[model samples]
Target: MTTLYSLYFSLVHAFVGLWLTQIINRRPRLLGTWIAVFCTNVGLILSTAVYEQTGSKSAGVAAVAMVWVYNGAFFLSCSSIFFTAYANPVAMRSIGWKLYRFYTAILVVTGILIYFVIVETRGYTLQKIGELFDGKRVHLWVKSPVDDKESDGPDDGEIRA
Candidate 1:
């Protein structure tokens, strides 16, 4: 539950992304490299927004299918990596294996359960799916104006500016 906090998500995901990118980059598999970078950079942003939203993404059948594949795969893959690090004596000796394994299991299990149980996007954040749909990219980081549907703006009785 504490992991729901904004800073925790940002820090963990950022660090994970960096770690994965570094490790995966050395691997022969380009998919891992791409997925790591994609999940980290774009995934981070989407998770941030979804995590902050009040009205969550609708759990339409399409969205559900997307979550099943993408979210399921991601969390499973991440858990595999996490359990490895936890089970590694060298990594654990340096980073306290017992505590790390406890946290790792908690996180991975929580993520898996949330993905399956939560139908709505409430606390269920597979930011990648949202990013896949809202796939617009602007170079710079400036705010953009929302579109006005009315031709003459709020001047008409329609009252939409």
Candidate 2:
């Protein structure tokens, strides 16, 4: 059933992405939160808009498929790197062992990169994410300008119950 396939892929994407996030990032929980927010906006909201705009279910399906395919390819590519490294091993070992070494290396490198290079934008507005690429280098642990203090709620001028 379509519903079943959708559910399956959603779960796969969420869990796999979460697992990979834990492996690759310094703050797994924070990154996981961002991933959830990202998926909801891009996966559900954007796809719905596409379906409405084109009046075709296929367009929406394609959008969802694109997200899944991209993630799947990323995961596979990481594994393939290790696979190739062990293709003609100088030291023989099980394929599982090769994968383990690859993942450990990835974890270590990711941790160093996150600590030194990646900025912490937890609780920040996604709108200012563009500033990350505005030719200004943002280092890890720098304070974000788009903090949650800028409320998205109703203006103070509005009456509250």
Candidate 3:
């Protein structure tokens, strides 16, 4: 049963990767930054799923190969995020490297903690999961809604009440 579930997930991951890659390749310019991010994330997901499925079985060359692929995909995804930030020279200049360094450190630490510490909330209610992260440690995890007036800007003629 567990093996079947793993195989199913692996197939689904591969399918999603192939579908998204086709779409991304078709549209070379539209949302290129986000498309790169999405493709990297899909690669990470596909590799991780394949690694888990292979590693659960007896150790062999296939398992070793999957591990290598998973490690490469993981680092590639992380580096894509960094490279995206690096490409934004104006933001880098205004915000400074210290801020970017801090952001990257936070991202890395969060990823590590999530992989090690986070529990599966598969059956939990939304409120239950929200409560789990509703502390100083999880600050800014949930976004505040944007006020209509603020989003409307000065020229867009939606009259304020």
Candidate 4:
């Protein structure tokens, strides 16, 4: 049963990863970033099933992975609260504008930061990626030179791993 569950988990992640890659390849960077942030929250749901039935070091590793993923889950709950406050009639009386407006401002600011901070890493090989980050801070607006080239990579909808 555990093996079956693991297989299911792997398959789900495979589909999600493929979908994410397609989005990243075809859409705006801000949209891809939002999708990634949303996906991170899904880890909290999967964490409960990570523990192995057998008592082993692998189980401990799974527990650690759960904790790591759990750290990102707070963003999901906070977003939900803000959305609820924005949508509810009674909640709109006092704090709705402040809460939801603040949330929107934060989202916009973070989206800008993510766009500037994250390097679009679609076609670069692992070695090329490492070299880019190896010795210096990458500056904003530095587009990858490989953008025009066709990527024979998984982002083209072919799963590599």
Whole-model lDDT values for every prediction: 0.40, 0.47, 0.43, 0.46
lDDT of 4 by residue, 11-67 (tens): 554455456565555235345545554444344223323433344566556555653
lDDT of 2 by residue, 32-59 (tens): 4334334433444455456657767786
Would you estimate the TM-scores of all the predictions?
A: 0.20, 0.27, 0.22, 0.33
Please state the error at residue 133 of candidate 1 in Å.
Answer: 43
The CA lDDT at 3 in model 2 is 53
Candidate 1 wrong stretches, greater than 4 Å: 1-26, 30-37, 59-79, 82-161
Clashing pairs in 2: none
For 80-140, candidate 1 gives per-residue lDDT tens digits of 2455434656654665324333544555555555445433322323343353346542122
Q: Name the top lDDT candidate.
A: 2
Clashing pairs in 1: none
Best TM-score among the predictions, by candidate number: 4
Question: On a 0 to 100 scale, what is the lDDT of residue 52 in model 2?
Answer: 58
For every candidate in turn, the CA RMSD to the true structure comes to: 20.2, 19.3, 17.9, 18.0
Better of 1 and 3 by lDDT: 3
Q: For candidate 4, give the lDDT of residue 101.
A: 41
Off by over 4 Å in 3: 1-72, 75-111, 116-119, 135-161
